[model samples]
Target: MFTFFIALVCIVFFFLFMIGLFLTIKSAFKFFVTKSVTKKQLLSSVIGTFLFLLIFGVTAVPTFGNSSDNTKKVSKKSDGYDFKSIKLGMTQKEVSDKLGKPSSQNDRAITYGNNTLYFADGKLTGGSPKFIQQQVNQKNSNDKQKKADDSNSEKSAAQYFGSKSTQKLADQASYVPRTQISNGNMMYSETISNVKMYRIDDYQTGVTTVYKADESKDDGLGAILYQGKTVTQEKPKTTIVY
Candidate 1:
């Protein structure tokens, strides 16, 4: 739309210039033939020339300015990519299914059969051991609590010998789940093997940030987490005359 407007304006200015040039030539011809130019004709010729130049200048300036501005806008828009979508609790396989393979991976070893997986460009690398150990410990504690509850249930069953403890057992078995926290460094469990999945979308141009379950800082690191190629636009070219 803007391009069409600029072209229209240029065309109008070119015609105006042609009209002014014709008037100037006519005035010159009249002066030469009559040996005396009418004041009105001479004034009209000067005014037409001035008006032509002024209109051309006015039209040309904004055309160039808007063209430059649009060029920049298109360039910046083309430079970045769009992150499509993400899902929470996505396992490694699920992530691969969604985003294909990662571009790179960095692995760090953590303690107690736990590990951290870092994915860049859609591939898994490695992770920390201490964090994994903490996660293992938490899981172990939960397991121990479950075991204790089972033992208590058995004892109550032997002592009461009736259905009176059924409600109590049901109440004890009911789970009160805690909210999951994403501290960025915490390692989430992977549904496939030892690999955990995290989704991230970011660009170097600082355009958009889309994360799967949570948002993170717009550092270059997030770019590594992206498992696929980024989608972007290309700028339109303009021709310039010398």
Candidate 2:
């Protein structure tokens, strides 16, 4: 809304500036031809033109600043992720070292939300099969299936995001941050090591989204970390008077 207001103001100022310029030019032409133009008319035209131009230039600053800011945001978000970097044979310690502690852990598996890593002899085995397979299945499916699969991958990969450690990870990676609203939900997003991440609030089931930056353009979702119930509100009930 603020952006829209600034744009509207810019348009108004630009229109005024153009009109003032035209009038000033016409006054100059008339003065050159008639050689009897009043000083008041010439001075008023010049002043009006200069004033409108100044106002337009001032209004334009925020417009250009916003464009530059949006460009920077896009550039920051365009970064790529390589979740495949977390290999099958990586040690349990190595996985923990890379992604931080799991939300829940046991002898055979360590979990991040619904995504889990299985281990044999303290070495990493597997996690996020849907996400891993997305690249392999990219060409064999239709757009609808691809989108469905991507949504699933998002849920699976989301296990790694929206945690306390994720904030640390973003800081370590020097990722840029931004806040925006989508579908009436307020979201906070950041570019992390290998994914684009989002945290959103106010829904029946809050879901954090972790996108493989190169392929997924969908903004990340959810308010809470994966593996936990997010904020929810029950519908207000109405009772009939007895």
Candidate 3:
């Protein structure tokens, strides 16, 4: 809206400026071509042209500043479009009451801009896949670091046993691998290192662990991390009141 207002102001100023400029040019031409023109008339035309330019500059610069301020205000509040009143386990009708109808929706979820809210059992179960992705990456990094530390410890033990701590184990394999799954609530995830990571919506609960898939399994050493998000809701209620 501020943009539109600024544009309108510019348009009005543009037309006014053009008219003033044209009149000034005509008066200037008359002053130069017609010897009868008075010195006062010529000075007045010059002053009028200067005033028009001044007005345009004054109006335009402030609109730009105001437009910038409006942009800041909008960015700060855009999240309020759908976050403040929404909660986990609200029915779709309740969600609509709070956030209005989603821009698009399907049986399981709805989308607003880049955000997506998923549901299971007919209630707003969860959203924020991005947060889940962050956890997956963090868990894998920790897992890989653990594998390195373990490798170093083994080398130190070998050196103590009078064996040369030569290099990485022959079984050292790919980078840490991970996977993920989410529903209305927290997710169920499995990282290649054999650690599970997930978070609740409010982020009030957190657990930390390092997984070693290679060490935990029959494999010798190394980590592979694959990732995914799963949507699950328990006893999903499908009906919506109103």
Candidate 4:
């Protein structure tokens, strides 16, 4: 509303400036031609014309200055990636042409910051570390808390691996139960694997159901239901001194 007011005032000033300039030119011409116009009257017309132009120019500067800033903000917003341009079966060169260079790359995949694009037989297959691809197209702040929940889920999900005492520690860290496997059996994600697997534990049965990360869903890390997998907390193998 305030911007509109400034713009309107600038237009009014410009209109007045044009009218004053026309009147001043007419008075000057009459003064020189007929010699009947008073010098004081002509001088006053010139002064009024100068004031109008000066005021209009000053007001016009800030109006355009504000518009320039708005244009920059729009430019910044449009600068983000058009991920839809990336299609499956695109060659590595084609992907690079659209998205520029990757942050890191190897034989199978190229990474853009956190998001990785996977390839097979020198053509695009899909992306890796699934969380990043899910986050790529989201422009709002609504999912921020859910992301924090996922990280916490990963950290404490491993806590469900061991004895009852360990499960107590996992329970204390706050897990958002994503799915119900059965009555009294629930699925929660413990992102204990670097390869992204799901570990589901039953609170009452003390039985944990593990699922491999589903490649298809945005919430691929949670509640996809694979059974009979052993839950072992990740630890380094001990080296024996020879």
Summed backbone clashes in each candidate are: 22, 3, 20, 1
* Tens digits of lDDT, candidate 3, 1-242: 99999999988877778776776887778877885667776776876698678777787778887997988888656544636566666777887887787879988988766667888999766776454345446667898999899666544432322121112111222321223325332222223222332222212232222222354555222332222222122334599899
TM-score ranking, best first:
3, 2, 1, 4
Worst 10 residues of 4 by lDDT: 160-169
Instruction: Show where candidate 2 strays beyond 4 Å.
Output: 1-8, 59-70, 80-242
How much does each candidate deviate from the true structure in C-alpha RMSD?
A: 29.0, 29.7, 21.7, 19.4
TM-score of each: 0.28, 0.28, 0.38, 0.27
- What TM-score does candidate 1 reach? 0.28
Superposed model 1: Cα runs more than 4 Å off:
1-13, 28-36, 65-68, 80-242
Q: Candidates' lDDT values, in order? A: 0.46, 0.61, 0.55, 0.64
| Rank list by lDDT | 4, 2, 3, 1
- Please, what are the lDDT tens digits per residue for candidate 1 over residues 1-242? 99999899878878888888788788888888988988988897897778778876886778887997889988656433212222322345554464445444323211112223344444333234333345546667888999798555544432222221223333433341112235322112111122222322233432222222223645312222223333233234688999
Candidate 2, residues 11-128, lDDT tens digits: the string is 8877878777777787888878888778877786787678667876776767787997888887555422335556666777777776677778887888765567778888665555
Off by over 4 Å in 3: 1-15, 23-38, 73-82, 112-115, 121-242
Residue 140 miss distance in model 3 (angstroms): 14
Candidate No. with top TM-score: 3
TM-score of 3: 0.38
